[model samples]
Target: MTLASRPAVVILSQASHALGRKIANAIDGDLHGASARTSEVDFAFDEAKAHLSYLFSTGRPIVAVMASGALIRILAPLLTDKFFEPAVVAVSDDGASVVPLLGGHRGGNDLARKIAAVLDGHAAVTTAGDLRFGVALDQPPRGYVLANPENAKAVMAELVAGASARLIGQASWLSNTRIPFAADGTVTLTVTDRPRTAAPLELVYHPKTLVLGMGCERHASTEEAIELARTALADSGLARESLSCVASIDVKADETAIHAVAGHFGVPARFFSAARLEEEAPRLKNPSDIVFAEVGCHGVAEGAALAGASPSGDLVFPKIKSKGATAAIACGPAPVDPDTVGRARGKLFVVGIGPGADQWRSPEVSTMVAASTDLVGYSLYLDLLGTLADGKIRHDFDLGKEEARVVHAMELAGEGKSVALVCSGDAGIYAMATLVFELFDKGGISDAASRIEVQVSPGISALQAAAARIGAPLGHDFCTISLSDLLTPWEHIQRRVKAAGEGDFVIAFYNPVSMKRRTQLAYARDKLLEYRPATTPVILATNLGRLGEHVRTVPLGELNVDDVDMLTVVVVGSSESRTVVTGDGKSWVYTPRGYSGKSDTGMSKEVSQ
Candidate 1:
């Protein structure tokens, strides 16, 4: 089964939509919206229950931006095995609270806390062990696996009830994690990745520390390669689940059978250059001159296995061969750290920092940028990051040089360094995320980018920031349109504007008026006036979520072209959008979601004392 690379954030209303996007950004997850609401996100679902049902089956973490009661009602039917269930969290629409609804130990609690940090809110974690001891016996960090998850509940209960626990293995990482443990106790926890039997009332965890090296002929069958690897593991009495990755020479980087074998075992296929593999020649059990002539390595399988393994690692299985394939296994020393043993796999993070404001930026964006060794973006945008961009290798280009920026970031990531391709507002919304994917699809320089792990982090878009600045003008159905005709033809822009007006969608215009391009915004205004009334509330917000921000409301007929610039986002209200004079004597634009009579279900409103 294929696994989802990231978590999903589900939103149902306009208030929740912004918060959901922030959560998704902080976690580098997919933003999903309910179809009933006006959603500008990654994916949309027709029905909430059906959407949740599908997400649950994917075995990926899920964060729902909705009321707790609604989430519980939708997921009650899908509740089965707690051990295998993915983490599910419920976040309030106003970003006030985060609740871990299920899989608290397995990831929900951590996800909720992480989201809370981004939103400046609090996590309502109810797990007993987590509350008392700040520990979850079942959920360990990367490279660690729980052997008997069934016994975790009993042990956690005892720990929460003030019973002491003893750790029986070397776990330096746990010391900083503040897990409650004693030198002597009734319960014992064994932390080892190797094969072992569990003692009475004792829990065992397996860390991923085994490196499997594989080599196959050019046209070797996938079945033969996979079977041969499995046979070798079985003969050695080693659990396949403990294998961290499959290692091979870079010459076979694109080899189909090798990748197929790695996929079958649910591990990544890591490739090393011939020069790197040759360094492990002395460690090879069956060195060959013919193999050195063919691949410039004495032993492809054995050399690669040893090269990827830790310094203290030893070859456990040596050169087990099939008709057209060869396999070897190297056992890393106990307490094997996966990140340290193998060559660093490249990673590219496409990040949106949210409308040029530090406060609006999610914690995930900050963390990702801090972790990245290289940063690529427009020169001005990089400068906006200020001190956060310090010490990292920054590759800045002109505003229009999007392709060059992406290419540079991809190249750095290909060299096994962490890279961040930064953008303004939401990366997926007419930003660098699309360009990065396009570059990857176009091949050549992007081949390295395609192979490297990529993640897109959402951010508060210009439209969302403008909507929040003014009241909720986008409470109902809405669509965003960019009036810039640089890349897209004006004909297509005209058609989209007409369609959006005909559909009665609340329209947000990006790149409304530029110095050279002036006619498109005027033409769009005329098209919108045909369907909307003269008194329709139009919001003009400039520099949203940044310094020198300005927001004002005007009637559709009175909108001045001079007031809007390239930095401004103009949101034209739909027919259903209404205006109210608040206590401050200012007009607030809002479109009712028609949940007026429904208790406990409405677009979250600001409460005034």
Candidate 2:
């Protein structure tokens, strides 16, 4: 194996600084002591959880000199034996190697080989990989496919004891590594010291799996809570298959998300009782308490960690916030070797349909929604997307209840649950996308959270569909102005109209002429006439793309004040738009391509000759 791809080393020693640095660097690895710094001299085990978390999270190979045992003792209480991380080999200051401590297949044996080569010393690597090639899967490492990540520690433990292991679906590059496979096809394995009859059972592993669901009433987020849990589990040698559920704070244990996780992992969604979470809660620097209490736990990370560990392992209290935390499953004890696996990112998509109509939808939109695992939005919107929501989990809320929908979808995704947040019309056009981004920006989340990738799927707006049905009023660049005084003040709307008049932009009116806000649109149209031609074409599109649709074009000066309603979209064309004659003698309104003589530059022209 190339040295470049080799996992780096971490040297931890209380004294014997000279020997520690030399021995660790001989393997061409970084010396952890020189690379780390802490001003607080009284730093204890959990205090360094932040730094240790960074090292263990990398899944690298590790080696520790049998030091004041402070490094090992401080770390031992937190790691799990199951994950494939850095190999850990222990040695004495006298330069004598003793045990292949952590990461057996993927870590420990490598440490043994490096030590043996450095001082002409003996490395206590009794594993099959080291004994055979004196090279190992953790050394001249051959990456193996462990079906279940949970059995990694147990398998590594056996191999280091000189037990035989046969890997199935072993990748080709691993042929030279110590762990062997039968070239014939499926390889058999035996984890015990006594060899058993060569069979598939000797090597099969069932992966460890976890499901996390939490809320914070305190300082911790899903990220912080889960890392603490991961460290504890990694120290004990357990691996999680995947996190796959999140339930609302009020949802019963019998809820679908909860039960589904149980069926997936063959384990129950053990609740990290809300009260217990509150007791351990740290004071958050931001708006996290509301989220935590709403979801019932500080964060699902705690649940994920607890579930990842041995049933006997206790919950580890969390340390202070990481300075922009590192993504890690856990920092475990040094290993003889480890069995690392691949990572897949979770997903979330939010879609808006504009005012309402399929014709306004973009192709990029429907495709995204079709691929999502869960759907979230208002009940009416969900019903509108009936065909798409058929089998997926629907997180439904009331119409104006936008924040809850975004939070719920994000929470579900953070738990490693792929989900989608549904909106009406372009999500960024004032639906759910903005809310989605706000949640992420708050840093009110957890460490274990799989950050949800927020995507906005665009759809047809009432004006665009309306414009298409009546005339080319929107062909020229246009600005949309909403007359609703609920959000934008009446003064702001007036200022915008003044700007639109100066810019020569086609103007589309939303929330136009609502009964309660009768004067705004009238004031706006009068303002537009100040700069625009009195005959500027006004097309009122009502019920665009829906049953009972109607579109009418009138002169701006002739607009009937009483005819406008909230459902109507008022589109007033710019000065360049005009009425024209089609080849068939049918009359049509259009905003001409500036090069009207012949050589066209419009989108349609480019698409054609």
In order, the Cα lDDT scores of the candidates are 0.81, 0.53
* TM-score: model 1 vs. ground truth: 0.58
* Model 1: per-residue Cα lDDT over 1-609, one tens digit each: 112536878887766766777787688676777766744555656788888888887787889888889888888888889988889998887888999999898889999999999999999998876776667778977777788887887777776677777887776655554556788887888876557777666778777778899988997999999999999889888877688889887657557898898889877788787888888888889999999999888998998788777668899889989999999998877535545544445778899988967667775786577668789999877876765676679898998887778888887887767888999998899899997778777775744456676888888899999999878998989999988888999899999999999999999998898888888877888888999998999999988876789999999988889889889999999988999999989878998867775555333542221
- The local lDDT score (0 to 100) that residue 202 gets in candidate 1 is 78
Model 1 misplaced regions, further than 4 Å: 1-211, 215-234, 237-246, 250-270, 278-299, 309-316, 321-326, 331-342, 383-391, 592-609
Number of clashes in every candidate structure? Answer: 0, 62
lDDT of 2 by residue, 1-609 (tens): 222223333334345455555664466443343223311111112234455555566664555454526556655765765454456566666776546666666656656767767766777776654565444332322212234344434555655665554554323344445654453423344222111233423443222222233322233344454553344335434343322222212223223433343344333343333444444334212224544656554544343333233233233332223332211122212111111211123357777755534434453564455456688888867776644454568888986577767777877765545576777666776567877777777755543232444567777667667677765767768888888888788899899999998998888888888667788878988898898898888888776665567787788888876878866888887877786667887555667655555554575675575
For candidate 2, the per-residue lDDT at 591 reads 70
Q: In model 2, state the lDDT of residue 130.
A: 54
The TM-scores of all predictions, comma-separated, are: 0.58, 0.46
Model 1, CA-based lDDT: 0.81
